[model samples]
Target: MAFTIPEGLHPDLNPLAWMVGTWRGKGRGEYPTIPTFEFAQEVTFNHDGRPFLNYFSRSWIIDAEGEIIRPGASEVGFWRVKEKNVLEVVISHNTGISEGWVGQFDGPKIQLVMDQGYSAPSAKIVTAGVRLYGLVAGELFYAYDMAAEGQELQAHIWSTLERQVD
Candidate 1:
C-alpha cells in the first residue's frame, strides 16, 4: 500500500498524498426532505509520474438483503494546481455529469466551486455548485452545495468514508 511519489507530480498536490489509497465506508444522505438513503462507496486515488492525481469512485445502495441496488460510477479525473493559489479538478462520470472545479486547499480540506454542464445520452444540465472535502480523524468528510432547479444554496449531500485496508 505504499506508492512511490511521482517525479512529475504537481507540488501543490503533495499535501493530498494521504488520500492516495483505497477508501470504503457507508454514509447517510438526505436531500430536501427526501427519505434518507444508505449507501456504500469506494474511492481510489493514484498517481503515476504525472502532474495530477488520478481519481475514481464507485458507489451502490444496499437493500435489506445486503445486495447492491444501484451502481454509480465516476471516471478518473485530474487533480492539479490551476493558478498561483488555486487548484482545479476535472471529473467525468458515466452518468453524464462531467464537471470542472476551481478551489483552494485549506489544512486537511479542499474547497471547490464549480460551474459547468454535462452532455451525454443521459441527463444533461448546467449547474453551479460547491463541494468541500475535509479529512478528520482519518476519515474523509464531504458536503456538497448546489444551485440548480431554481433552488437557492442548499445542502445536497454529505458523506463520510474511512480508508480501507487492502
Candidate 2:
C-alpha cells in the first residue's frame, strides 16, 4: 500500500508522517503484581498542520477468545519533533497519572524514556518508564516497559496493530 503524507501536515512532522493514522490490534500484558492478561487496543495519531502530532489510545482487557472483559487504560498525549530527531512527549492517563517523556526517532523506530511524572493522591506512582514504537512489516509495533508500585522497570505490554483504512 502507498502511504501519502497527510495534507497540511507541518514540515517538522515529516519524520513522523507514517504514524498519522488509527491502528487497532490485540496484545498481552503482565506485571509483577498482576496476572498475565490479553487486551485489545486502538491508537490514533493526527495532525492539524501543526508541528506536533495529537495522540489518543484506549485499551481493554480481553478474554482468551478476544472478547472484551473490561476497560483498561486510556491516554491522550502530544508528540513533538525537535532538531536532530529528538522527540518530546507529554501524556495524561485516565488513571490520574501524567508524564513527560524524551527520546529520539530513527527512521521508523522511536524510543522514549520517562523524564518526569505526577500522580494523584489516590493513584499509583510510576517511578520510571520506557516506550518503543516501530513499523514492522506494515504494522505498528508498540511496547511499553514501566516501573511502578515499587516494581522495577520491565515489559508491561506489547502489540502489533494494522493501520485502519479510511
Candidate 3:
C-alpha cells in the first residue's frame, strides 16, 4: 500500500503519523505478583494538527471463553517528537502511576524505555519498563516488559492489534 502524508497534520508529528489510529486486540498478561490473565485491549493515537499525538488505552480482563471479567488498566498520554529521531511519551494511569518514556523510531518500529515513574503511595510501585511496538504488514504488534516492586523486568504483556479507525 502507498503511504501519503495526510494534509493538515502537524509537521512535528509527521514521522509518527503511522500511529494515529484506534487499535483493538487481545493480549496476554502475566507477572510474578499477579495471576496470568487475558485481556481485550484498545489503544488510540490521535492528533489535532498539533505537536503531540494524543494517546489513550484501556483493557478489560477476560475469561477463557473470551468474556469480560472486569476492567483493567486505563491510561492517557501524549507522544511528542523530542528530537529529529526521538519521541517522548508521558502517561498517567488510573491506578495512580505516572510514567515518562523515551523512544527511537526506525521505519515502522518503535522501542521505548521508561526513564522514570512515580506511583501514588497507595498504588503498586512500577520501577521501570520497556515497550516495543511495530507496524508489520498492516498489523500493529507490541510487547511490554516491566519491573515492579522488587521483581526483575519480565514480559508482562503482548498483543497484536488491527487498526479500527483510521
TM-score of each: 0.81, 0.99, 0.95
TM-score of 3: 0.95
Q: Tell how far residue 101 is off in model 1, in angstroms.
A: 0.4
Worst 10 residues of 2 by lDDT: 1-10
| Candidate 1 C-alpha lDDT tens digits along 37-88 | 7677887887776667888877787666657888754556878865555778
Better candidate number, 1 or 2, judged by lDDT? 2
Q: Give the better candidate number (1 or 3) by TM-score.
A: 3
What digit string (tens of lDDT, one per residue) describes model 2 on residues 1-166?
8888899999999999999999999998999988999999999999889799999999999999999999999999999999999999999999999999999999999999999999999999999999999999999999999999999999999999999999
lDDT of 3 by residue, 1-166 (tens): 6667767789988888888889998999999999999999999988888899999999999999989999998999999987758989999999999999998998789999999999999999998899999997798898999999899999999988988845
Model 2 TM: 0.99
Point out where model 3 deviates above 4 Å.
Answer: none
Error of 1 at 114 (Å): 0.3
Provide the lDDT at 87 for model 1: 78
TM-score of 1: 0.81
